[model samples]
Target: MSDTPCRVAVCWLLPELEQPARDLAARLQLPVATADSIEAELLLRLGGDGLSLQATGADAPGAVRVDFVEGALAHRRQFGGGAGQMVAKAVGLRGAVRPTVLDATAGLGRDAFVLASLGCEVTLIERQPIIAALLEDGLQRAREAGGEVAEIAERMTLIQGDAITFMAQWAAAAPQVIHLDPMFPHREKSALVKKEMRLFRPLAGDDLDAPALLAAAWALASHRVAVKRPRKAPSIDGPPPSAQLSGQSSRYDIYGKKKLG
Candidate 1:
């Protein structure tokens, strides 16, 4: 699939969105501008048309392990100097966890972006052609931006294929953390869902075979397999996590296979 073309428009949130906007534009290979009439809402409207919008309160560059509710969290520095636990856990074991991570179920490259932001070389494996195409376009746009994060985005690769098949072939360097964020069924009303999340739901349906994916990830990961699950739900296959990071309605479960020193 081909990437979408970048479009030029006036952004009202220019002063606040300047750098990110420029970076987004550069990544999309479009010309940057300071249009005063464009509002964040307008950008969001246009972003629906396959453009990655940069605006206030959106996640920062290099944010590791973003929770849907954490708003937008990113790592402060690119390399070293040590920051948070998420970053540390991701980089611990002599960078074992930080080794190339295979986002087996890379829906829209959100989690993959976080992992890459945290310095872990990441490969996003998305099955849906359209979603993968959108991710590819967004990534290409980020690359064109030519900023620090844009450069990091370059390190994050996207592949259109079934993760189950890809994971089996990725043997040379097994991912220490096979990050998985499978699409689960949402019971709430559509109007209640966030605009971004709503857009993603249809493009990426619930991965009903989540248990199998977990099993596969467990087999492929060298040290640990991290999974994101809805807070109300039980662990995949009914086994509890060795450790979990909880937020409002979701959790990051760590299924430890090899002991971490």
Candidate 2:
């Protein structure tokens, strides 16, 4: 990962978010400053649009933010097929039982949100402090928004720490399905990558410790472990998956320790 620190602060135009911004900065140990004041490689701005990241010298038109109440997340919640989507199938969501999921690598809480929308209780673990803060803020706003979105947000939990350590300590009380979506090295051109990917790649880097995470999942998950990877990327180094669910851009390698209901 780049040694450059990500400068984060609230957007000056939205003074109401300043307190929360300061709280976030304290939690992440990041310095708070105006967008133009810092000579940072990346600036994470918290405001009405939620938390967004912008490259200081990039020519991008807008910032990348995580908004669970609207945009892609809202669209997916409203229209996304429930318990029958590829992710649901990968998590073995069938019959009447909705497996409790431990999303070990909950980058933006996208997958975990999907699972929660499908009736599964999801615990999201994001090791990166900044990403976790963004996700937590989004969830908080989602809960206050009320209605179906709030209900789904209620089923999701967020934690900030290393997944391997968390799972190692919580193995005895582990959830039935443990989900892993470790970051992989993508070869796409910088400009061509999605804004979110472009912003997150520099912060989280590749998951060099994924194999260790997978092993810990195996030890903790009672029923199965699901690993999400690029469509053609090889599975994480460890025991082979028992089944596979393929999607257009990605695939789920399912390691079943026991039969699902």
Which candidate gets the maximum TM-score versus the true structure?
Answer: 2
**For model 2, how does the per-residue alpha-carbon lDDT over 154-241 read when each residue is reduced to its tens digit?**
9999999889999999934679999999888776542336777767777887888889999999999999999999888899999999
Pick the lDDT winner: 2
lDDT of 2 at 130: 75
Clashing pairs in 1: 12-38, 26-144, 26-145, 27-141, 27-142, 27-144, 27-145, 28-141, 63-74, 63-75
lDDT of 1: 0.60
For all candidates in order, the CA lDDT equals 0.60, 0.83
Reference-based TM-score, model 1: 0.64
| Each prediction's number of clashing residue pairs | 10, 0
Error (Å) of candidate 2 at residue 74 is 1.6
Candidate 2 ranges with C-alpha deviation above 4 Å: 1-11, 188-192
Among residues 3 or more apart in sequence or in different chains, the pairs in candidate 2 whose N, CA or C atoms overlap within 3 Å are none
Ten-residue region with minimum lDDT total, candidate 1 = 61-70
